[model samples]
Target: MSRLRIHRFAFLGDARPFGDREVIAEPREALEPRVRLGERPTDGLQAERHFAADEIGDGHGQAGIERRRGGRVHGGASISAHARARPGRAQKSAIPDNPRRKRGGIVEVPFRLRFAFAMNLSLYVVTVLIWGTTWIAIKWQLGSVPPPVSIAWRFWLAAAAMFVLLRAMRRPILPPRDAWRFLVAQGFALFCLNFLCFYYSEQVVPSGLVAVVFSTAPLLNSINGRLFMGRPLRQSAIAGALLGLAGIGCLFWQQMAGHVDDRATWIGLAIALAGTMCFSAGNLLSSRMQAMGLHPLATNGWAMLIGATILTAGSIAAGLPLAPDTSPRYLAALVYLAVPGSVIGFTAYLTLVGRIGPERAAYCTVLFPIVALAVSTVFEGYRWSPVAVAGLMLVVAGNLVAFDLTRRFFVRTA
Candidate 1:
């Protein structure tokens, strides 16, 4: 009698999604791991389903395995794979880990902390750096074009490129029908109104003041997350956010000084606040979409398309010319903003929000000023003052606190 071995599997049916499960079975090996649909009927016990490996790791994607008794299935001992196409490819069984698997007697870092943190950090850095530098490009996009029209052009190009990229990768471009309503809300808030408010606000207020207001995003996200999503208010995240806000204010203190009593200044501040709220709302929407199994690329692509259309319509109604600026500076900035700033930046950012929680991820807004100032220093003659240097340290401190990075290295592992 040949013995059957269980390779990869997940528990099917109900609340247990894929964390810590034990199936009682000398599971069959001929059952391909990747083929997720398998029902093992028991003698009056609940029907059990198995999957090979899935996204939660050890395999790939989401899957589950239910506990069985004496390693037997219903009235039968085993079953074959359900036909999900594999053209002439042999299935490879993974090696089982040794009970005492150890690396030189040193425990390894937890995958949740180790792998997830590293990837999230990379995404976070890319998002901050790309968006930060885009301010300069946005400045280039300003003259000879209405800011709204320029923004419309940026998103049109961004959405087009994003769809092309998604098609090349064979990822789904359309979200579920249920998702479009939220997609519209997200497109309006994040892509359309957010940019419009910011562009207009910057005209009235000092850019630094606008940035200072924008830095409040993490706090607002935290509050909204707790109220709407029921996510807990983390002390460390709040502390970090407050610290980052202070750092940002210090960093831009000089530039931020202006006629605060001016009516236009107050209006600009109000507009900046509205834009920040829109941004926070978008963050929440992205989280919700991810929970719905919608990828950031898909959501952003759709949202960008919707946003561009809306902006273009509004610009047309406002009597702005829908002409393109073909100057080298304008074209270069448009390309950079469309691809790197909008596409890459938003995807990386929203993905981070899904992984790290919105509050912690919104801390990226705080870091934006640091990168923007650095770029400004190089290209626009920005001089760093002692206050600014102190501000930089505070911002760094805030990120450390926000991420809670220290505990991972010193984590007590078994």
Candidate 2:
């Protein structure tokens, strides 16, 4: 019987044999054999090949020796270990796949979710800015043309623009027959009466004041939602409503005190309040239309056309001159209001209402006033007295309270 010589060697950190005792090798003088006495098949050749590759260029070094100790490679290296081992390659592969890890810590937001959050935020900021600056443009449309005719021309251009856009995009122009009734109602409330009231109100009051009054839409929306949609009116909403009302009273108190006998101020206030209610009603209608599977852009296109038609017919009947304003300023303002204000602003806002419930989305009403007031300060000479500043703060506070953002802020701080 031939005597078998068994050899054992420590593979860096692993204390194990690399080969089986089944294959007996002739004692070679070239390299020392580090073999274990075992019946398992030897992985010595494979280990030698891996070790040679590691020493030459692979750079795994002693780690590769430990990996092949038990006749197979182990895959228990942590992310940090892999990153440290292959800094460049591991960084490229690991961080993006596990978006949870950043700067050596786990953050846990997936790439797609982060992208969607950014998109929603962008839409929100765009909507607020467009609607905010739009009030000043409405002021420019006041002269030469009656509010009805100006409103008519505005929506007609918007409708034409939207229709052309829809055609170019290959989107359907007409809605379902059942949606027509809702569309008509939406046309009347949103595009027709709401704007009519706002334009007339701006004629009597400053456009900024009109915008301030319109800020009450969220409160009205909460009420309408409770009445029509059977949604509960939370205590925060009621508190917000009270604060908003008090702020409005504060805003108008000076005007009322100075000119108690002026009836036009009262009328403007009433009209603005009515317009806000109309806007809130339209919000509910839009929510209903979306629930019925209608896209806001499509519904808005048809509704704007219908509204323009009605306003045009009413302007003709009332004997208001239906001619377009020829002045450069008026024309430019009209185009801006039609395209960005009506088309883009309304679409973005209603889209938000559809995505995040109307109550939360209506916070745009609160934010728009700040932008409007800033523009008013620059263009309309809207001086900010301490009283006006306090009223504005109260309005902002109301928004924070209603949205539960105030509570969230305190919790974060705590």
Candidate 3:
């Protein structure tokens, strides 16, 4: 490095040393030193001299460059002086070191994080299987039991189990004051009313049929969202929705043509439709509750408790059948319904809502019917007619269309 000695020059007037013996002009008169350096060139001359001598620049020089002219270098001195240093051409730091950088720009998580996500995802799969299988189990259980009795028993048992589990974990069963109303409403919709209609429908209609009816919930939500919440449907959403409805219409037509004379079956189908509407409405309710800062599990627990109480009271008041010769098989089914179906399923589903959002997670409804059909075939000897098979294919196609999966397939083909 070539070293340069700079002399005090009043004519140069508060200039910075550039190359050997050259003083760069002070940015402007605004940057003129308060004290005239001509009278006492040697006064602050020490600072300038030291700065000129030092390869590592001094504070004033740095300050002169930074503040007055965009300084590019600074010496290790006082902070104020360091602050004045030339704003060094910022070295491109490591991504983690960058302050203004965005996340989601990189795959930052390690394999360990990916493995953890996979485990959580596996738990979700277990939840789905449990939920799907229980639909058939629920149908079987409802065969002999009154709908309210069965619903009440399932929830009471679940609440008991949850209470025990919570006690073990030292978690509180009682919620805070503000949450009671939401919990009650949630309970009514999710537990009492939803299950009441579903179980009653399943008693008359096939479980697989109930599953198909429930699959239309997203389509219902689309309408509900548009009407109540003023969410405008995109053209793609509209087109997909129409296609899905057309598919459902094909299935409905097959069912009606095959079994049009069964009034009881039609009643059951009507009840199932009502139950599904309630279920879809609950989605919006749950979303609202979440926005109000309630945890889904806590809301569900409270709601289940309220639902159980209401159903029990309603059963007694209506002089409905209470006991159903509860066998071990029935009891085991109830346990499964309460724990895995009600608790684990809701927990996993709500978590999924938080992760991927409500709309995307609801795609589970499409898959759920397929699961129900498969389970029914195995357990209940549900033989699919040729028409039924065609209906099933339509349902699958509808779901693909609704979810834009078929759109991608077509794009790829094209």
Q: Quick one: how many clashes does candidate 3 have?
A: 7
lDDT of 1 by residue, 11-82 (tens): 211122122223222222213432222333233332222222211111212222332244333312233233
Write one digit per residue (lDDT tens) for candidate 3, span 227-343. 765444544444544554445444445444555578887899899999988776677566555544345566667777788999999999999888864688888888888888877
Compared to the true structure, candidate 3 yields what TM-score?
A: 0.63
Per-candidate clashes come to 17, 3, 7
Q: Once superposed on the true structure, which residue ranges of model 3 sit more than 4 Å away at CA?
A: 1-124, 167-173, 206-209, 229-256, 261-265, 379-414
What's the candidate order when arranged by decreasing TM-score?
A: 1, 2, 3
Candidate 2, residues 22-53, lDDT tens digits: the string is 11111111123333212222533221111121
Error of 1 at 206 (Å): 0.9
Give lDDT: candidate 1, residue 78. Answer: 34
Candidate structures ordered by lDDT, highest first: 1, 2, 3
Report residue 56 deviation for candidate 1 (angstroms): 17
RMSD of each: 9.5, 21.2, 20.1
Q: Over 4 Å off in model 1, which ranges?
A: 1-113, 406-414
* Poorly placed runs, candidate 2 (over 4 Å): 1-116, 206-209, 244-256, 412-414
Ranking 1 against 3 by TM-score, winner: 1
- Most lDDT-accurate candidate: 1
| Candidate 1 weakest ten by summed lDDT | 53-62
